[model samples]
Target: MSGQAVLGVEKARFLYGANRVFDSVSLQLDAARTALVGENGAGKSTLLKCLLGELELDEGQIIKSRGLKIGYVPQDVPPGLGDKTVREVLESALPHTDGGEDWKVDVLLDEIGVSYETAQQTFGSLSGGWQRLMLIAAAAKLAQPDLLILDEPTNHLDLSNINTLEGWLADDDRLPMLIVSHDREFLERTTTRTIFLRSDGAHSFGVPFSRAREQLLHRDAADAVRRQLEGKEIERLEKVAARYRVWGVKNDAFHKRAKATEKRIDRIETERTESYVARERRLELHDGEIDAKVALRVQGHTVTIPDGSRKLFTIDRLNVAAGDRIAILGVNGAGKSMLLNALARAYDPDQEHYDGQAAVRFNPQARLVYFDQKMAELPLRTSLLDYLVAVDGATTKDANALLAKAGFPYHRIKGPIADLS
Candidate 1:
């Protein structure tokens, strides 16, 4: 954070089509591990692209030092890579029309703490955690660039993979990095500085993420107190001036003094200290009113997934009341997954529909939304506004209002759903 900056952005501005993303933004980046953090649709990705030279500034300048090599870790791998092995995946990272060297693969695999023997497995066959680690390692090893950029690296990683990434980031000081992540602990452990993108502008803090947030909150609270005290003083001065004005009708000298008091009140009001208030973007969720007395009920509810070997689950009785919160817990190979599938099918235990061997009942008006442990299949090409309009319970105007409630601004709703943060 102390050395001369290798990159400088001066009065930077960028626009997506006609919507202005950044206005007169300015910042400096030296050889430091910096974290880029902000709410969704706050232009963090756009700024990163500008830094990487992938996007051009609309009305400002970016000064970069000579021969500034940048390595970018991709947010996602291409779908066709599922059939490739780990070694093949790493080798493909090179510009190979005919052939490429294999030693680079071993070196990067070792650097990322993966054994060479493990490279024989198909890249897609590994757990999501290991896939992300290997993908990052491959991208990093393609070229030992001076600056490495990672965006949301923890997206598919598990706890163990996340710990591995933490070690990799903290492994050296020589590597300058710009990391964009929602993982607060990862930013705290890796980044030396943080840049926050807000509606007002991009603000840089020479401290860890959590510490910077704490400072912002504390400063805002103090400003609130000062504003409250100043409010009372302003009110008192106005009342005194009003009383003097009433007396001025009877005496001439009182009128002159009343003018002075009015001037004093105007000075205080005009020259008052401006307050600094921090804004937060959040979505509030509420469980609306459920009129049904009995939302769902089950009697002798049992489930089993058979591989022609053993029974997976057998429940004696299960009951759910109105507004009941339920959680299913089990280890690998347990029937937790099967239970959910059974609910979706509305199946009974004895290979029959509802009321076969087990009695299952549900209110006809009840609706459910399920989030499986897989990426949602969204219409990536469709605009967010269009997608929301397609969904039930809201008109186009109502959809936009709901998006506002969820902290998304009006201009961004017309963009593609996949482009949304």
Candidate 2:
């Protein structure tokens, strides 16, 4: 709330060829941790890239205080760091100094309550939540950046890990941060300022996420009402101008009044307030229906690590009927993903791979689709249109129609999926 401006962008505009991601966008960051929120594909990630100089704006420029340092944590762990030890990964953030700064890593880890034994393991061996937390710790503690930028920091984190992150971010040191996250509760807990990135521009507020969102909605409503009033005034002026023109046929003096009224109408139209109403997009799900009461059955299943190193948990019996919605809950290493993977692998539409003694079974008519939370299955380089067309039974026309329905512009269909926000 009371801090110097560390970084900013003024009247920024970025375009992917003909597709504009955001226009006239501008915001400044200070000492308070700020939440940068918007709907998916609204260029939140793109804006961070622009701020970090990873991407160039088509128009406008980035502003940073001289000698400013920035620490950035992406949504995903960067590639090739999986095999490195956690200590090595944290050490990478440090500048070369006399002797070394490796001791700082242990101190930071101890402060965060991560065990020393875990530090020696490969970075990828840790749980997804811990990996993200370690990266953030390295950035905040080791890098000593003037401003820290985090993109989706709560992603893949369990409730406990999320609380840990909230505490770390809300520390009394008051490090400057620009956090892009969809987690409203997390933002409200950790951030003091909020910036809403919309297509028209960025709106900054000196309040937490919920309060900032309320202010934004109120502003939009006020603009809408003002526009309506302006429209009515323009209509009234037009009618008066038309009447004046008719009267001018009888008196020359009325022609000047008609011209004056027409000019006022034009002025009102020119200065009219423009409000943004985001386009509607639907994430359509498959409407496939199984013609059976029981869609899946599981019995005597021992869930374990993928390599069968050790058992995680055991399930005696479970049945999922058609229209039944179930949630699997667990902490970080509780085999929730492993159980899901086992069930997804066990689904056999042909019903030829299983005997009556199978641990998992699905109805003959049951169809299955597994969505990996990391989205590793998707080919990032593939165009959206091509990816959609590659689907079973999907024609090119059908793919285009689906993309349109999902609110993707035609120009974006040819762009790689990685380019999507």
Cα RMSD, each candidate? 6.7, 2.6
Best by TM-score: 2
Clashes of each: 0, 0
Task: Evaluate model 2: give its TM-score.
Answer: 0.92
Q: Tens digit of lDDT per residue, candidate 1, span 216-260? A: 667668877887887888898788878888999999788888899
Report the C-alpha lDDT of model 2 over 288-353, residue by residue, as the tens digit: 588889988899999987789879999999998987878876667677888988988888768777
Instruction: Specify the highest-lDDT model's number.
Output: 2
lDDT of each: 0.73, 0.86
Worst 10-residue stretch by lDDT in candidate 1?
A: 347-356
- How well does each candidate superpose onto the true structure, as a TM-score? 0.69, 0.92
Off by over 4 Å in 2: 1-5, 96-100, 111-113, 284-287, 389-405
Whole-model alpha-carbon lDDT for candidate 1: 0.73
